[model samples]
Target: MHSLPPLAALKAFFVACHAGSYTAAARELYITHGAVSRHIQVVEKWFGVNLFIKQGQRRVPTPYALTLARELGGAFDTLSDIALRYGNGGRNNVFNVSVPTTLSLKWLLPRLDDFYARFPDANLQISTANTEQLHIIGHYDLLIRRETSGTEYSAIPFLQDHHCLMASPALLKRHAIERPIDIFSCPRIETLTRPGQWNLWLKAAGLDKSAGNGIRRYDHFHVSLHAMLEGIGVGLGPINTLSQEISRGNLQPLFAKITVAPNQYYALTPVGVQKTLLHRAFEDWLVSQGQRDIKLADLPL
Candidate 1:
């Protein structure tokens, strides 16, 4: 323990490397920028290495420093998780979750009231982001997103996401979309987040990719779904997530048999961390909700 560098300096260096700037690190640590720099200098001196180099009015981490940062990140996350687990005598009911944007809006939000009704004592902090950050394990207790690669974490499949062409009743009436070829005449809406979606659907339907007139691009599925509901165009929609809209007759699925199963939604938890009772409760509830929604959606499977 006597040979160990100062814990504060190591923590500061770890944070500064990730934050990209000493000022940002200072803000996060509630310390002055100079304090952060001094802490980093202490770490550099203890380690006998140059961790950062100035480049065009900004400091960039050296390759060796980035390697150290990765190691420190995992160590810190493990320490934090351990602290969180026993810090309150295992009474921490505050669960943090990260979810993709469109899914949060279309599916999760609608079902949250029921969750609160069941677990009134549960404190849920939900964040919606398009990208998963490296610090997700440290910041969030769970992540709900499309299937991700890698076996580093435990990913439990919850919901099935199969996309099909859909449009409002009014748009369907005007387009005369009886045959697959008739769909080319109507406006096509594309979700920018799900690239190559239109092509995938077209290929599945045995139609040429260039069949549609033109496409209006939206960043997320919820936005494109809204455009479809307004009769702006016909777009691909996930059946299970859009169960409410489909059941209410706001949007009608076209050629339901031509749907494509791209991927499924998953609830991921960091490996090695002990799951609290709250974690198990929420995950079980989510799985149950997904099963019920799939049946309600009446998907062709």
Candidate 2:
């Protein structure tokens, strides 16, 4: 038996705690910051416990509050699941999906028009935070991420972000490059922000050195890709990540034979658990789209 907290207050509390900022929580909840603050205080007064410690502008959760918060979050997720399953007639399918920026922009958004056109009733909420921050298994209804664990979901292999040595043709043509060892000893090496990506790629590609010197890092893929596109330096990027550019003649691969990176883009489906029709439809449609793209990408490499 659960003693129900005030629905509004609990909602506010969950958002505030999850977000770690009342103002941010208010924006997500579509209410004013004062309302969120009032709701939390109301809950605190009702329970005779302090849930938040105000340190200047930040709200720190007390130990009790943190435990309560986890419970509250679990409760909300359960209620959300119930609402998604039974609140409407196969519609009201608001599915929350967690995805990486690389897939979100390049792949998912481009194919989403069909989904919207077919199932206009389904509403989708996409969380754009990197997979490193959000638990793909914990909260989201679906996650399209680089396949790390493989057992995370229904297990669609989808597309491989194959690691490759790519650079602008001008850079390659100017420098004589025959062996993998040639990449290092260059002036600058452009690489992505992922942890150990550059070093690991170099090592996996059978390069001479693992770390130390000849490495320039960029926080975003676009920045690194742009540097490579402008003929600045060599970039070790995914095969699929460079496919579009290669087609457009903006970039070229150094080696024809590629390695499906130790990492890959993956799609996870939350099926079997009852959900909104929109969610199910979107999941099915996404898989269908992935199937369709495989045919489109049968380009001669």
Candidate 3:
């Protein structure tokens, strides 16, 4: 560590590379572009190499810069997490959760009345975003994600289901889905933002590849579900989220055999957070209820 680059310069280089621009990185750090540039220059000088390649108007990072960026990004995020955890000297009973909006709305939201009933003293907050930003891992007490695994905490397999082609009774009746092959004559299927999901679901239902053409797609499941709920068209999506509507006779499942989605439901939290009584009771209840739907070794759908 005798002749190391200045920490500021190192940090600036990391931010610039990670953010893909000196200006954006500077804005995040609340500093001048000149200051960030100077720091990058200092780091480059100390390394005796170029960290970034200038192309016409764009700043492209070199191979060396990419590797360092991730480490520094993690470092900065870790520091932020620690700062917030220590800074918050709040009541012990407060709990926070984050989940994707569609999952929260369809499965978790309608269901949280029970959690509150079980742990009346605990205050709960839920956020609905899928990505685990570094700050969130430290801030949120529990996070619901549709992922294959968990990172730092224990993961509970909450709910599992396959993607089903479904639509409002109003739409299906008009379109008339008498068989899987009949889908081609109907309105194009809708899906969450994930690419190729419609094609996969159609193929699973034994329809020909021609059946997959011209399918409309959206990124968020909420959008797709909303489209289906409003009688827009058939949608390929999770069964659990659409359960209530189907039960209410407002929607109809096109096929009972669904195409599997890679991610089911997972509970993520830091180590020991679930052990707390506030979280424990809710976790136990949630898992027991979910077990009725999901089993690890068997084919889930």
Top lDDT: which candidate number?
A: 1
Task: List RMSD in Å for every model shown.
Answer: 5.6, 6.5, 7.6
Q: How well is each residue in 1-301 modelled by candidate 2, as lDDT tens digits?
A: 8886689998888778778888889999999988998999989998899999987978866778878988877777777766784577745556778877766765677667878788776678877754454354346777776654544456565665556677788887787767667776454555446556665566666765544465667777767776877777887766664555666777777664544344555556655545556655676676566555322235433
Ranking of candidates on TM-score, top first: 1, 3, 2
Q: What's the lDDT for residue 122 in model 3?
A: 63
List candidate 3 stretches off by more than 4 Å. Answer: 1-92, 130-138, 148-151, 212-214, 272-274, 292-301
Taken over the whole model, the C-alpha lDDT of each candidate is 0.82, 0.68, 0.70
Model 2 Cα displacement at 84 (Å)? 7.6
Tens-place lDDT per residue, model 1, 132-172, is 44345456778887755577568889898778888899898
Cα misplacement distance, residue 40 of candidate 3 (Å): 26
Which parts of model 2 are misplaced by more than 4 Å? 8-46, 50-90, 114-122, 132-138, 148-152, 169-207, 210-213, 219-223, 226-231, 258-264, 275-301
- Which should have the higher TM-score, number 1 or number 3? 1
- Best of the two (1, 2) by lDDT: 1
TM-scores for every candidate against the unseen true structure: 0.69, 0.62, 0.63
The per-candidate count of clashes, in order, stands at 0, 0, 3
